[model samples]
Target chain A: MTELNELTIAEARDRLRKGDVTSVELTDACLSAIEGAGALNAFVHNTPEIAREQAAAADARIAKGDAPAMCGIPLGIKDLFCTKGVPSQAASGILEGFTPEYESTVSQKLFDAGSVMLGKLNMDEFAMGSSNETSVYGNAVNPWRRGNDETALTPGGSSGGSAAAVAADLCLAATGTDTGGSIRQPAAFTGITGIKPTYGRCSRWGIVAFASSLDQAGPMTKSVRDAAIMLEAMCGHDPKDSTSADLAVPDFEAALTGDIRGKTIGIPREYRMDGMPEEIEALWQEGIAKMRDAGAKIVDISLPHTKYALPTYYVIAPAEASSNLARYDGVRYGHRAKLEAGDGITEMYEKTRAEGFGHEVQRRVMVGTYVLSAGFYDAYYNRARKVRALIKRDFEQVFADGVDAILTPATPSAAFGLGEMKNADPVQMYLNDVFTVTVNLAGLPGISVPGGMDRQGLPLGLQLIGKPWEEGELLNCAYALEQATGFVEKPGKWW
Target chain B: MSIDTETAAKVAKLARIRVEEDALPALAQEFNTILGFIEQLNEVDVDGIEPMTSVTPMRLPRRVDEVNDGDQQAKVLSNAPDAREGFFAVPKVVE
Candidate 1:
């Protein structure tokens, strides 16, 4: 029998609807796969009991014949999302034993659509690092290897576990949040598809806030069609989240016509950074060629402020993160350090935070506080915001000039070995967000589709960025590229 | 733009994160490196450019001044490490 764990969301939905397989069987296959693949360490919390319960419920819902596309489909939830009664640590030590009393709007919506939750996936500590090594549960290993090489590679973070789990066939799809390229970069590294929908498209009500302006939730899946299918269920206007866009949710899957005739794809010259790997450059050209062959007019554009995006992102994201993270003081919830006899309220707060946060999270919090301080606010935070406006204006000008989307390499390189940059300068790890941060800075929708592989047979992805609030149109462009590239290679399972 | 140990300690104090004596030097070094990289933003001419606080331009949504939902105080305190008398208990400040 074909392993039910390997079925795409779309394929599993078809099988579920036709009574070809029960959701219980599918869920069982996934549970066993997860158990057998413990070496990957993709899931920090495994809820097999809950999985069987939700799958049974889904099977009953499917029998009623009015089920949604996600009915009976098994999926993974990133630890960043608060699933009520489940540990949602955000992979940070501070939230060590915290169980949310309420559910995140995205995960709640997925559950309401009848998707079975396999468990909570691992991620960077408070979504702070580029590699999964920062995760409190330890690194989530990528299933791909360089021709029997025993070197363990990273599934790019802060959505590392989501990427690794989906790529390793541990689940059909998973949830991921992008503050600065968390979803797209990981998807590119793992040879899967991930999309960061336009900001406010999805409600941030219960998802742990990290750079509130840039954090948007999206899907990590096996194919572009699966992303379209899962994204429709994950987005909506939530009155609870004041920033949620008050727009009607459209059928995202319907937008994928697999046709991109007459669309204009912008190739930003500023993205062509010096010392960029030859494989990455060649893969970008191949993406442009494929888009042109599919009839998208490839035009070279200039985002002059591109050089400052990483710096701007580093400042603004940390500034917002500092403010958002202040809520974790030894207070009403989360981990609290042991207070000594002389320790007062201030000591309690300080010790709790110092012990709770990891090195990277602490570094960012300090950086954020420094920039937002009285003397440096205008020079650092305010200046970065103005540069952010210029970056947004650059995209607006191109869109106004009839460009439908932009194409670039999803990551600067392919999946790097774990611990490769663990002890390197912090700035070196921050460079991983080079290509993908601009979209978050602009609050635009972007997707990473597997275009081809590097020399070691690891997958490299090409990113397509679209105008704000045009995810449907963007999905269509990605669909055209997905069809043209024909990249259906899966990572040979070593885990 | 350089952050030495004194400035790093001040920033850590403001952020309410405790840095030990040994960790302060490392923290200061990391801060200086980050600040050095972010200094590149000064090269750009952003005169007269308004700071973008949000991507979409919309006033904050207003809710009618009426109680829409509540009454689950128990559920709210379920995750609380210290809850007493329907309120979150904290270290005493007024003693």
Candidate 2:
């Protein structure tokens, strides 16, 4: 029998309605599991008290016979989303001891829907790095290990902790934000499901900003069906966030009919990188074969500007990050430098920021400052923005031509050992987002579904990119893909 | 385009982060490597293309310029590292 902590949100909901289990029992099971799993470093902040209180309230709600789908469900929130009275530092030293008086719009929605908060999960500082190593709370270790090897692999980051927790069944599911593949790449790395909905599908009101134009919040789960259920609960129109779409939240769980008979799935030729591993290639082909056998028409498509996505992203993301991060000036809130007798305001700003930020965060800030500098703005920032248009246009043209979804490999490789690439060039780490960043730039909905395992027995995933603002349709395509692949592998409990 | 140590120092100052003089060389080298990678954008022809302002084509939803809520002075200053008399305290700016 599956452990209570391991039950999917859908299962837990059904059992909850039938009175087979109370949420407090499930919460206790998860809290005990988290206590035993310290090696993963997944849950940075444990809120068992808050969780128990919320779970008890959920039980009371369900007893009244009017509970939503997410009622009684426990979840791990990424540290980026500020929870009222929780130390939401975005895993940065700059925000030490700083707690917010308000909750982020996304977290509030989940709570109002009767969900329980497990705790704040770990992440890259300011959501800047592709690996979780840059987190001030320490890196979140991937629960999945290579066959018989003892090396600790990364959970692929900035949402690394969310991926680790979901993969290890530490929580039912966790919220993740994807700005150029933080959610999808980690989901692929840890053998789970993650979807980055259309850019404005979820509100970003109180979440820490990385790149304003690209960052989006979505669900990371054990199955595509859970992603659908949780995503419906997480998204809606919020007047607090200007970018959030003022549209009706559909019953996403109802859209998963598992009948994608006549959808057109596009196979983009440009995603075939030169040095990609054969296992990833085989995984992509397997997804294509599975979708074709499910009666979906597969056609070869061209995304001509795909090769330039990463370089363009590095330019734009850092440039925006430099601007957004300017708020940490040792004033108003967060860390402040100790001042000498002769020190002035400028000196205080310099010392505080230097002491607060990690090396990767500092590097990106410098890169951003350099690109947005007067001399290079037009060459680096403006040119990249124009290329961004072309990239988005590529998706629009394809979708306009009746391509319902695009299929590709989620990551270029499986999870690497922690510190494996630390000695290598930073550009090597940036290459990991190659296949996943285009979805963000084009502002399209994308889902990473675990399809198969690598030779090392690490999990591999296939990504399905869908049209903008059509996540229900995308989840259906992903549901059909999940049914065809039937990937149900779980990570062994090493932690 | 490559960055020198002097330029790196200038950027660090501009960004309000202090990079020690000894660390400037390493910072400049990292910048050059990233900038060199980003040079791939120059190969694309964007002669008449307009830079993208927003990914979605919708007009910005403008609200009437009015204060919807405020008056929480204690809540706003609660997270400050240094606060005094309902205000954030900082280093002396003027003599």
Candidate 3:
């Protein structure tokens, strides 16, 4: 039997389909791997018995010659997504015992495709922190490092667990959500491939939303092809999500064309900031060189409004988050604070909310309330929205200027030591998403592919920002780059 | 602008979050720090610019005026800590 840790989702599926391997065996191997790697803190919950039963059902389907694309694959689900009968805490103490009766659209689709659920992965509380340290269950450590170097590195947040699980070979792939670089940043940190499709491409029906307008669900996998295959299984229009697009779902697997001859690729001048690290710059240049060698034309373009993206996102995302999170009152679902006899309804609300939300979640809610307040709405929220519009317009102008897509570094630098920037104020962390957030604001598709590693052997990623609904072209370009760079193998130490 | 502890307490109350009286000073400090960061926007020349509500500048398609959802009262209240007769039960607010 091939080691479960080394097999990609595609390889595992092919073997399972041909009766070379059974879903039960693959799931058992994954469960054993999880048990061995318990120190990594990748999972918040594990359901071995449940996974076995699901795998048995998948095997029965295969025997009957009826199986979906992702049938029988063992996968880790980020805990933020609602799984019926399974507790879906956003890794926060507030929602300690909350369990949803209905599954999230993404989770339901995956289960319907015969994907076996290994368990719920860990994450930062309410997907707030960048270091994954804010998780109530504890942080997920990166699985890669030099020999005997025990300095724990952050697997990135708030999808840190998903990335760590995929990296540690605990599962073939995992579901991840991106709101201001959550999915792509973690994937970059853990040396995996994650794609954040265009806004509304995937349904957000039951995901515990952090920032409703910005939150998007995507796939995290070891290779670009696996990501594409998983994405095809996860995406579709849902009538429940009013924002879900009615556009035709393209066959993402078939879209993986290893051809980029004569494509116009834009190297945005704005991405080259004044304080970018030398290694990141070198990696960006290496990515451009590879693409150029693949018969693509590279052009220097300016997004003059690039500097405003982070500030605008901070304002808008918090404003929406404040509203979306209002559902967590003590009267409804989630944790309720113990109240005295004299305490009234208002006091109940105050106590419950104060006890339920974490510092970062509270900070966002406060900022959101302040911005949306009667007097300040026009000054802060309104003005930030205008800046967001200008940023989107900037992308449109660049695309109009014959640029097929934009290539830049996924993050400003490789994953820093855990807790390195956790206390350096919020703007510092918000600045980390400067390159990735603008694409979300523009409602366009963006992807992160493994570019190469930095000097310290930490992984680096190259980001591709495509025109709205142009994920097909973006994936083709990424496949071309993935083949040319050939950086898909796991880190030696991680193995 | 400097935010005092009392004002910070009021902000917390208005936000429906409770903070211990002793913790008010720290909350006040954090609020002032965040306000200070937001003050940076004043330096940017946004004069004569129209405020934008969305990045795409496209209005979402409006549905016809009709009742659509909110019929799943049992499902909605199923997760509640205390629900009575299909409604959230809370302490009395009347005098």
Question: CAPRI verdict on model 2?
Answer: high
For model 2, the superposed segments whose C-alpha errors exceed 4 Å read: none
**TM-scores, one per candidate:** 0.98, 0.99, 0.95
Ranking by lDDT: 2, 1, 3
Q: Residue A14 in candidate 3 has what lDDT?
A: 84
Candidate 3: tens digits of C-alpha lDDT, residues B1-95: 78899878777776888889999898788777776766656555666676654433344666788887667998888888889987988888898
Q: 2 or 3, which is superior by DockQ? A: 2
Q: How well docked is model 2, in DockQ terms?
A: 0.90
Interface Cα RMSD per model, in Å?
1.0, 0.7, 1.9
lDDT of 2 by residue, A374-418 (tens): 989999999999999999999989999999999999999999999
- DockQ of each model against the real complex? 0.79, 0.90, 0.58
Q: lDDT tens string, model 1, A156-212?
A: 999999999999899999999999999999999999999999999999989999899
Task: State each candidate's chain A TM-score.
Answer: 0.99, 0.99, 0.97
**Model 3 off-target regions past 4 Å?**
A492-495, B43-75, B84-87
Looking at candidate 1 chain A, the ten consecutive residues that score lowest on lDDT are A330-339
